[model samples]
Target: TQLLEQSPQFLSIQEGENLTVYCNSSSVFSSLQWYRQEPGEGPVLLVTVVTGGEVKKLKRLTFQFGDARKDSSLHITAAQPGDTGLYLCAGRPGNQGGKLIFGQGTELSVKP
Candidate 1:
């Protein structure tokens, strides 16, 4: 069984604060993806990292994949109230029938 563990299960921060959370696993994955979901809506894909040591950025969010492909990190800079949402990490195991393994998820709240 493959499991992805996300850190800081819950976060509450003031606007303009920066934060970084992580997803880790013992198993190496073929690919990893990040998603952000607001209440009453489906999760929206943020970014996908397929190569080891790959890094991608979208607006104020930055994502990095571990060199070993077994971990990932997300960093948000100068967060705003609108950034409040549930962040999730999903991984596709190497040759595992195409099923994605999900992390426990991190809930973030940014207050003005």
Candidate 2:
């Protein structure tokens, strides 16, 4: 089974703090996507990393894909209250596209 394990299931930080979340798996993936979900809303796509060792950044957020295509990371700088949300990583296996498996989800609380 393809499974993505996310570390630090919960995070609480004050404004301006920095944090990093990890996603790992034993199976390789064709592509990996990062999402952030707020209360009463669906997950919003943050970034998608397809190439091994690829790096992408969105303002204060940085994302990296593992060289083995079996892991990924998300780094946030200067977190603010607006940054609070559930962070999830999903992977597509073998080009199939019915449903995307999600992580347990990391709940983040950034207090201002």
Best by lDDT: 1
- lDDT of all the models against the reference? 0.97, 0.94
- In model 2, pairs of residues that clash are none
RMSD of 1: 0.6
Task: Please provide, for model 1 over 3-72, each residue's C-alpha lDDT reduced to its tens digit, 9 standing for 90 to 100.
Answer: 9999889999999999998999999999999999999999999999999999999999999999999999
**Evaluated with TM-score, which candidate comes out highest?**
1
lDDT value, residue 25 of candidate 2: 93
Per-residue lDDT, model 2, residue 99, is 62
**Candidate 2 Cα deviation (angstroms), residue 4:** 0.4
